[model samples]
Target: MVMETIEKVIVNLGASDIDSRLEELLIDGILYAFQEQIMNDDANVMLNEFGIVVNALGQRVKPYLPHICGTIK
Candidate 1:
């Protein structure tokens, strides 16, 4: 699902536009992945690391993300 969505976006926007859209798409993908993971009992422990990484990456991407995207989720 993530790959297909990204492919569609790239097809529409072109590779050159990746610098702007990459973070947006990546965050969207991560959120979906997290949602799936949370549905499993074993995923709770693993998601700790995942959450940390997402938080750090989100801070770095804050500058380029859309104004609303920068808001706390």
Candidate 2:
């Protein structure tokens, strides 16, 4: 399924866009990991430079990212 999405993105947006969106994807993944408390300090460094991931290894990491988290309404 992920491959299919990647293929679609590459076909629709071109392979050149992949590198440009890499940072967005990384930030999204890191945000998800932080929200789920599943990421460790050794595994994340991109946001650490900004002190955005202060509790990466904590049992309950915070969700301070700007993106919206969908929920049943």
Give per-candidate clash totals: 0, 0
**The 10-residue segment with the lowest total lDDT in model 2:** 52-61
Top of the candidates by lDDT? 1
Clash pairs of candidate 2?
A: none
Model 2: per-residue Cα lDDT over 11-52, one tens digit each: 565434234356456446545544554346533442342232
How does model 2 score by TM-score?
A: 0.30
lDDT (Cα atoms) of all candidates against the true structure: 0.50, 0.38
lDDT string, candidate 1, 1-73, tens digits: 4444554554565444344466677666655565555346635543454444444454555653563343323
Best by TM-score: 1
TM-score of model 1 (CA atoms): 0.37
- Return the lDDT, model 1, position 66: 64
RMSD of each: 8.2, 12.6
Judge candidate 2 at residue 37 and give its lDDT: 43
